[model samples]
Target: MGGPEQQVFHPNANIVRKAHCSSMEQYRQMHARSLERPDEFWGEIAEQFHWEAPVKSNFFSYNFDINKGPISIKWMEEASTNICFNLLDVNIQKGLGDKVAFYWEGNDPEDYTRVTYKKLLEHVCKFANVLKSHGVEKGDRVAIYMPMVLELVVTMLACSRIGAVHSIVFGGFSADSLAERMHDCRAKILVTADGVWRGDKLLHLKEICDTALDKCSKIGHNVEKCIVVSHLTRLSNAHTQKTPGMKPPVHKTPFTPGRDLWWDDEMKGASNFCYPTWVDAEDPLFMLYTSGSTGKPKGVLHTTAGYLLYAATTFKYVFDYHPGDTYWCTADIGWITGHTYVVYGPLANGATSVMFEGTPFYPHNGRYWEVIEKYKINLFYTAPTAIRALMKFGDEPVKKFNMSSLRVLGSVGEPINPEAWLWYYRLVGQNKCSIVDTFWQTETGGHVLTPLPGCTPMKPGSATFPFFGVQPELLDENGKIIRGPGEGYLVFSKPWPGMMRTLFGNHDRFETTYFKKFPGYYCTGDGARRDEEGYLWVTGRMDDMLNVSGHLLSTAEVESALVEHPDVAEAAVVSHPHAVKGECLYCFITPNEGVHFSTTLVAELRKKVREKIGPFASPEVVQHAPGLPKTRSGKIMRRVLRKVALNDRDVGDTSTLADEGIVEALFSNRPPEASKLLKAC
Candidate 1:
């Protein structure tokens, strides 16, 4: 993680209205079905999607009792079909050749583009050829380092079309991050662009790629070549050329290079595409790494059949997608949310999804609203952090849009505050839509716990219910499952189709990270509680579980209690070392405007947490601040806060931090060590 160079100013998003949902009863039947006769329920659901070869047995088998762990897994075990066939092969024959798969919205609202199934297939075909020309093959991993663009999507589908395994590294990742992933996968081909533009700034992606390739043992030797799209490959030369067709000699000279090939040239005469190679249903389609701090990024391998089945089913259910509807998930494809929802999920269901290539607020604060207006986007899915940021600007810019097309709203990446949830529900959704705050991870494939638009009643801050096949349980420390809504470790007591097979080449780590935590149960890295109403609310990661005098406490609970207060806009709580107690509680608070900050607000917040939860949950210290540190996805970087709070004095691994400047701005105190250390020590 880069230190001191990553913080960016963010504005809070306005959220209004509130999502209301009912009893967990009707959802219970589905759970009962998933448990008792899983084959019947899930097998029927899987039938809705296109499968090349139909299996005779509905479910081969399913089981997961806490003692057994992975409570249930339905294997259409005998079925053999490529996921690409489901997305591309079947759609063509139905004459949905012109069906729009992706509607792209760039930072510049004017730069709109659409890729139909026919066009997407052609690009995938051509790119598959390009990959083959460069020596890519089935099982030989390929690395794609590109931005949120059409070529990136094309590269992914191409990998699946040719049965090649792709490992996507998000464009914003540093060379060290990219190099680590490249070495882990030992990819044969590297797909990258020279550079990319984010709002007014240009990112030197190709330069970073070249630098990463130098250190990557796999790419340095095994990598055939790097495929560079002719983007402004460097920040320095971004504005050198006036426009693409302009008569600029120096720019034209480097537009296409000997080692770097232009996408325009690569697609010409590269066939309307070769036939998609069919493989075993279990054959890995791609390996999308998770957000790891260091070492090797967890190469979460997703296979074709199980992955497709889960994404398609969960996408349709969680968002309540209607045929011919426009869905927008403003996430980069490098992450799981982007991989499954942005691409595979919508495409499998033959729905149109908008792929945004820039920040929500770029050219103007109204960028997001403008896209919603222009696209008439029906279902808009984004992160909680983004919503909180937009809340700062109030409802002014959002009023500029005629967002009648928006029918459903979604929150992913992290648990959204009820206040921000209400804002999105009111201002953006206009009370007519459903705010389905979903919870799942890269390892889980699709949304495991979420509200299904018309099916489940949504609780403002709650993730609501488990997806069709998932069986969720809240467990206490002694390996006993907690029945009522109480804070504890979150466990998926069964198997999910989209679940990661292993942490590529590291089975032991996989077993240790997930399974070992709770024998027989797939320990979700998060801690959650089922409310009295049975609505599930996620606190944060398991490691985020704090110990106060040996009592397990979650930062989520305290933060949630703080946000429940009218004046408190946001909060981040972490453990600070105490001589007597192993770790004491400390919180950084952000108050809403028009509310004067003083000792009174801090006292009020502390009392709120104490009265609402318990006196033991009281914060030892509460400091009101302008803002708290967060990730790009909106998750509070409490780890950073913990280090500072404990008087470590060192600002740790700031590269992962969305606001590095906030570190210095927040921590005025100093530790007896060199400044800006990358480790916790």
Candidate 2:
């Protein structure tokens, strides 16, 4: 019932690309053929790419049963391929070299750059040679910690060209978070930048990298070299732009003479010619991590051939991308969405993808519309959070710009709220572009459930149907499969090409976390409902996690961060309803016996969480409690805290609590008092 006024919107023939199937019947036919004859369907799709060798089978003999034995899922087992060739070389070989590959618009309007397939290939080859010169080889892991820039794209492709598995930690992550990821992967080489522009603030990325490297070295991760890109012109006097109100920082990045190298210096010495390294289909392409329920994040491992095929296929079908059309997905390279959609998918399809290194409301509220008009972007993919943020500025800013070039619109990261969905549908799309509310996760390399813009009929809040080769199911609390038209936990019953191979260095955790829950099916950890006609509506996460502004943040991770503060004895973190971010974190802390709770203490604790996790995980409400409601076994009653955070009068079943008095004590000092305290801080 929470779904937006359910209205069925069919495909608009005027906006839909002609190459895509125009009806649901064609989609159903293709889906049926994909499930019934996978080899034939996927084989035909694979033939569109340049594979070094043909795949003999779609999948090897592997059972999905977790209880019976270990689940071994492998796709394209006998094929040999290279992702760099498909993304870069193939387009160049087909005479699309001169066509624009990436139109990079920097944070400041004065800064801009464009790269063609030919130029991109040359940069990739040069970087690949640079990596080889530094002893990087196949199976070696390289760590990239950079902001949204063209160099990040080159680094990813260069790693792929040389068969090195690259792990890109988002630039916004804390040093501790970056160190943990680097240590987990034991990266041989590290790539970073001196600084990055984020609105008015310049993030000193080199300082963070230095701190992470210090920890990595201590943990026995012997990173051979660090390549630092001097990205900020303000760091040097000669290139600095003197503005009336802009004040640059005085911090200078230190360089280690032998161990560290300049990006340009290394590129200058390296030759712009390197062959793509052919790898087996099952070889790992990249490793990405997701916020796990536990304190530690899980490193999701995605393989080469299957992931590439799935990414390209979904990009082509979901957006109905054509040869000359331009596509733009405004996501950073840190997340899986950016890795799959922004880089691999669009490039593999040889589409002109916009790479904007700024926010939607940067210089103005119509920045996105301005770019759409400037580049004539045919497809615009973004998050629901961004849409909601823009909605706050009203429709006038959007009306001022021309968005006529947009043919398809997309929503990702989290489920699109009904109100935000309608605004995006009417204002940005002008009822002409089809809105694809995509639903997937970091574990799934590409979108699994979404509307094929040209084919499926879109409902405002629903992610229309499953992509080809995906079989979804709804399971009740007792693990019984719910039939049609019901609400339950979401689970996948079949193997998909883009699925994660395992959690890096923790296959046991992967098997237990995802497989052990449902035995045979992969647990999505999300609650979902299917309409009578079988359209899926993601009902948010069922775990102790919150999708705050489309970024996944775990409650346990924040709790861990809060407790790391010496004054905090214990903490309970929960999500409360938020208008814009979907959910915001609220913390209830029981200080150490003698420690006092003050506004300064609250500010320090918030900073602690920001440094320990990331800036996004900082709790909006930090309530000081004498003690948290806990059971005899010492489990904090998070539900009671959650109820208090939401100001709900009905506190469910306090009879089982070891300390019932703590509930009243906690609620008496809830967000109203906490908000006053936070405001003072």
Candidate 3:
């Protein structure tokens, strides 16, 4: 129930006066100017930042032709800059040394930590010195696998300070997943921790790192050193620990003496004065891997200067952040949201951000609201998945806290349904703060389609407008542009400063996947509709992928895992509606000619999927099918399968089906026991 008619929250007087644009008319004018004369518009904004060397030109070549080789998009290619210096040192030079940089909160309420700009710089310098002592030089890839702790931020900054590209893997990922990333990046050093507390249990992070290192070494990965941080000082020494229903390693895992070093030991005598490295603007700052349709993840590489400038500018305007205002974005550091908004974006703007170490529902459903009240957080940003998950517990948990301190609320990661957006506006915002439903991805380093909190109008389900420098286009399947008020595949017409330069080690795949689809435009892989007023409503992905609770999962990856079992002959995986998670996987498998299908086989298949990928990818439903609808060339018709999984009676045209009887067979002979199996599990 959100549209142009919804009540709007105007920016504060001070905020409006200092913003890039004050009103709707000014926003439209500035947006047009950014597109018409981007060089002049962006060059002025870039001057606000501290560049090591002046930029000669904003663009290398302005050509978006698909037939003319590759898109030659380059910005500030010859300039030199350092993101760490712009984030910390520049702020300190402006007499902001005593301002709070990060307000860290632990799982338990009693545990807390605060670091000012001066202290954060000191920590980063010391860690940079430690990394240098361990032979980590420029251009080396450093893998960071740690929980949401202060050390995580310090390590990332230290890596950037030394010109080393950091690749951060999710802490919950399995050992195989970690090894795959490490092997792909050829990481020279690995950083981890002993253990971390989640809810009432301890996750043995060091154990996972050790197991992943073993796999990495076996795969010819030459990691020179592993730096282990002691999160929990006194973990049990026993190799195995068994709880009632879960099996978690209770002990602190051991490390190799010559190749491993403790965090404290490395930082003991290190000097706290290391100069930030001067890297070319095009030098890679970090490599973040996103799930791929072909089962192997692709590392999306972002550069130093362009990504930082984009992130900082967007953070300043979108959130309308003021000095001394606390910002909290409840996202993991491993994801792009955290990398941009939580760390780089906020720090580059010199705004105080909150780092939370626990889940939203761990201690209670009210944990987020409590933090907002506890720290006087003004801007709150989080994924729509968390908002929907918390909606199930009703408004009682949210009512216990005073939410008047919140001036802006944001939804990211996935499209927010109308119901969830309404609940967030009414309950969490208390009708005082504005809600911005931002639509972007891991490839775009910053927000692409979002309403600037104070400048743009509020719309519940729609991502109102594109960011200033972004040019969005809607195109039909035949490569024809749909100008106004139409639904089509979403594409960006021009390259922006924040867009990913290339995929690590796979430039061909990057071009083939994104540009090859639409030829002249960057295909976003998602369908969308533009209203008469030019607001964008993003429908889910149009490809063979699923956005399960904001995490991208490939249907092909899940199908490949399912068919790996000996009992399965072929498999087709589809997605269906979910209440909390945006979507859940539903697998249809055809067993071998004489193989018996039973719950035992289902359990085995699930285990294989969990081992191959991560447990988050295990299908919610596994149903046996005698035959699947396919075309003449033997391609499984996923559209037909998706309709069947959703229990829709209107099955589309069967004229292209090789076997028309297969659809009837699949629907009539569907296993009744499948529902029971899903419920019991």
Candidate 4:
């Protein structure tokens, strides 16, 4: 399916006039310079941060061609720096210590906290000392499994301060998922919370930690220490009335005599000052595990200096951030987006960020807008899934709030559909704010293809162009580059500073997965097409492309068409094994609130897809779903949908799902008509 070929919305004149790169010509010139003179462009940007010893000779070197040498990429090889120091100390030294670092919005609407740069440094130092007292030295792995609390951010920075590589597992992950990650990383210590309130439910995190540790011990991978933060107790102390749908917070959690320690007790005796551990630029900063095609998760590792520079640079330009802009990225710290935007990138730039600890639907549908208005948030970044979900509630919830403070809006996690983009632009932004459709992945530390808010004109469903130094090209199946206006696999022709160093402990897998595909290009595993305007459109994952009776179709294109039907809130398109047509589309759709799913609705959805993507792309089975299974990060679990469509007994891992019950619900809620159609598969 083809993407939008022409610009739909021009950048807001007011924003463009005040932007860092005020004109398209200026942006083009800077982008050209970034590609032509890579070392000079990046070296100048790197100088903005503090480095112990700057690179004297080669700033960067890489060999994507595995045949020429072992696949390698190194940046600022001779430099040494501390990410924690640059993010905190540098900003403090610049007299920004009294500025709010993070505005924490807790699950309860009344519960909130403002942490300043100096206060954050004190917390980080205290936590670093706590880790040190527990024998967590440099190079040791620390697994952090906690909710979206202020302490979570502090723990990450603390790990960086002590030169410990942190692997943050999402709090919603099951004990098995936690155990697997801890085992893979061979973590020496695990930091957790007693319990956390998500909406109304209180998740006993310390109990989950205990179970994970037991599983790890059984597997001969023992985590020596577990530090527990009493988040629930703190919440209880803050509010006299208990939150609805949640039981009163427990006074204390079950603890082990030798291994378990309390966060409050440790901080009582811990010093508020600790020295930053200087690490090589090439040293790993964090390893975030992402789901792989093989059912196992891949630990995507990002280095210090390069990742910091790229994240900070992208944050400044993509969001058009100012010194006092109140930025908020609604993502959990476990994900790469939160690492780059919510904590590291914003802090490194000395920007105030919002760290929310709840869902969009909780308390009310207007919760997100309420937070925005309450904080007067200037730059708002969130996933398209959230946008679509909120769209189901209609515009009243959003229209009631004052979003006048919003200057720039951002879409992440997935490619946004035209309908959702228009809604976000018209309703939430009031047609004044610029929308930055960011496209990147866990492997890429920062944005790859995106529109600079104030520079590039917005296209409803397009990523627009590549970020600085990101040379993206479309490559055909035969390994030949598709120069212009063609559809093929998306790959980067050259390496950027933010690219992942390697899959942790799996250099061969990294080489084969990214480099072996096209020989000399870093494979993005995504399919895309370039419009006549040279704007790139990421269709979906390459595997999501289906060949229906020799007709190639992208699932994203089909889903977008289905969602345009007005009655549908969200749709996930997957393929089931077919006998006649090589493969047929199996669609699971969640109807909008107050809209009932009926035979008429199903037929209309199929006709919508046919009209948009041709008859071959029409879904054979349209299953009515109450909800689509999604990870806590709001990414739909398409793999689970594919397996369920095939009626496969082995549905793989459900541990990472935000709501495991949704899987069973999808199976049981399959309409009879859908079952009849699915039989042909």
Q: Please name the candidate that would achieve the greatest TM-score relative to the true structure.
A: 4
Tens-digit lDDT string for candidate 4 (402-492): 9999999999998899889999999999999999999999999999999987788888989999999999989989999898798999999
TM-score of each prediction: 0.87, 0.81, 0.79, 0.97
Candidate 1 lDDT by residue in tens digits, 623-661: 666777765544576767877675555754565455568
The CA lDDT of each predicted structure is 0.74, 0.82, 0.80, 0.90
Top lDDT hit: 4
In candidate 4, what residue range of length 10 has the lowest lDDT sum? 240-249
Error of 2 at 112 (Å): 0.8
Against the hidden true structure, what lDDT does model 3 obtain? 0.80
TM-score of 2: 0.81
Candidate 3 has its poorest 10 consecutive residues by lDDT at 234-243
**Clash count of each predicted structure:** 32, 0, 0, 0
Candidate 3 Cα outliers beyond 4 Å, as residue runs = 1-20, 58-64, 234-250, 544-681
**How close is each model in CA RMSD to the real structure?**
6.6, 11.2, 11.9, 2.0
Per-residue lDDT over 515-567 for candidate 3, one digit per residue giving the tens place of the 0 to 100 score: 88788899999888787778887875777667788766766456656665756
Give the higher-TM-score candidate: 1 or 3.
1
lDDT of 2 at 43: 76
Q: What tens-digit string does per-residue lDDT give for candidate 2 at 87-117? A: 9999898999999999998887667779999
Model 2 clash pairs are: none
